[model samples]
Target: MKNSLKLLLSSALLLTLAACQGQDVATLNLEGGDNIVGGSKVSSWSDLSKHVLSILTGPGERIQICTAVLIRDNIALTAAHCVYQKNKIRIAYGVDLYEQGNEIPVDKVVIHELYGGPGSGRNDLALIRIAGNLPRKYKPVALPSVADTPYQGQELITVGYGRTGWMKGAENDGRLRQVAVNVDSTDMNKIWIGRSNGKGICQGDSGGPTFLKKNGEYYPIGIASYILMMSDDPAKKCLEGGVLMNVVSYLPWIHQNLPSLN
Candidate 1:
């Protein structure tokens, strides 16, 4: 609903891997089949249910357009691009947006100091503080430890309230979704994830979470950033792979800003 065409086109130019040489591969077009290309609808509540949040932009007739992850009862983490242009934002939790959920107003949005926007994808992280504490159902997710290491071929799960398919365009629909992707590579600030068995990130998934499991618990390792279109066909939508901002690399910055967490 926020007119993804502009964002998609702008991101297309930023996909070149050469620009990101030292950090990671330059951006490439996304390509794939179905499932998010292959993701499935989340059926019921789970540990991930409370930590994943839907971000709604605009006033009055707000719509779920992006995703965020809760790191505290009143704090959430998302991509810098998701909150950079707005003064106020709203986030929702629960199974369905229209049916059952809580829409919390965000009072403060803090974007990373180094974030350079669509072109560079540098420091593409943000933190949002809700005006008040949420109910117990909205639980905080753990951040990855600084010592945690990411390797190629590692399997990771990504969760969001984004589009199920690209042909129909972006839709909130109020349902949460999950997809599994494999880490293709990693750098100091970002991780590249490729669709595993057809599952990948879509248009509305920006600012979502890419989780890694440890000790039977899931920790957020990356923040959904951008997707690459795999095909040259202008008609194709949300085709192939995507990128996530590595959370572990920014722990010190996060701790500095969100002092309460310390």
Candidate 2:
């Protein structure tokens, strides 16, 4: 069951901890097709915390959960595959989803125009705007500028709500987790972070933010898109590099869609 569940979606399977409406964790399908992602659990909403939130997208029984970062008071950014279904989607605010937090209503979800539809992960980026103001703690994180480029050997910090162990369902606990991965390479479309000392991403981790620190503050440069699988074994599947949709490359499109962001 574990082997079958982990390889359900695309040939490459994009990534998302997508599950049924009531299930704790679903099989791997789209981006961040999570399994046991290695990272430290975040217990407090301080420093670079809280800026990240979970997205719950329901289109039929399939409920896709992905991580998104608040870029504006009411606007958040994530990978296109996360909210592509665009059904009854909502954003959950808090370090832990099952905890005492509110599932905020989303007013809008705009996927990138260039995004290839289902199974085509090209230009996988999107924006989500909620209906009201969020708590002050969930402040918006800064977006990278068009001119900005990730320096060589940049240490990127990634955050996700994905599973923490081989059998530990990422969304089963709904707690946020993080890891710092070094840049293996980057291109106009994506940033690639190789598996670090055996640590990488898994389900429930899609659309999460990859931050580049500058002047002591973290700036979002990319969002989770897919993981390069090296093995068919579920435990070793996510042991390769992780790919992120470069947020910096989509600045123009984002500005055009969300004019207020400009």
Candidate 3:
């Protein structure tokens, strides 16, 4: 979500906001949390990185940054909170925010009906239909089908434009970065990954993509939601792993909205 951690941490004192900013994932029961350890800078929209996107939301100087994944030429998937209750939402297709790329206007936004609000929600997923075609260099990632049972120790690849460090002021340069994490547990709506292993997420990453690799290909299986706090202070967000919205479980709803998905 654009406002992610830095901006939204101002909401409540020690609690209230559990998810990322803007989407403010409504404090989940994430079992484990992690850091963005061993992440490498992405220089191009090729390979698996092609599907990742940066979201510029809000208005004027307060425009917040977030991330998303393209599933079709015009359809992109993201966290509902990231785009919800916001304005002038634009989708940027590029590796770095400052670099040259296509920033397309969003023609349609499909936020989950179950989404609670900016400060809370159950299902955090959302979809964006751009007014123009995606850039030539950009490509969609493979999507998953029915929801799969999330087991402990399962590995996944996560990509987003969020803070690299967990601290409140940690640098979130709006660059495309990625990290690998393992599933620590699960519940009805989210898959918990990491827990103080020093690898996870912070602000500006909400609604990003978490991929499951199979047969030499990557498939988006999860959506980046929020960070579980390690202490009463929201700054302690990064130390805990993080929560991922299970994409498989939302396929029916997704296909229902973007009927062209299937």
Best by TM-score: 2
Q: CA lDDT, every prediction?
A: 0.68, 0.68, 0.68
Query: RMSD in angstroms, candidate 1?
Result: 6.9
lDDT of model number 1: 0.68
Candidate 1 vs candidate 2: the TM-score winner is 2
**lDDT minimum window of 10 residues, candidate 1:** 26-35
Model 2 lDDT per residue over 10-129, tens place: 212222322312322222334433422667777674666668887876643344567888888889898888887676778876776555446778877888888886445588888988
How far off is residue 83 in model 3, in Å?
A: 1.0
Q: For each candidate, what TM-score against the reference?
A: 0.80, 0.82, 0.81
Residue 216 error, candidate 3, Å: 1.6
User: Residue-wise lDDT of candidate 1 within 164-260, one digit each (tens)?
Assistant: 6555344435567887889999999989887545577766677888899888788999888877655654234355678888998988888888974
As a whole number from 0 to 100, the lDDT of residue 243 in candidate 1 is 84
lDDT of 1 at 92: 68
Error of 3 at 204 (Å): 1.1
Residue 75, candidate 2: alpha-carbon lDDT: 90
Tens digit per residue, CA lDDT, model 3, 50-71: 7887776655344556678898
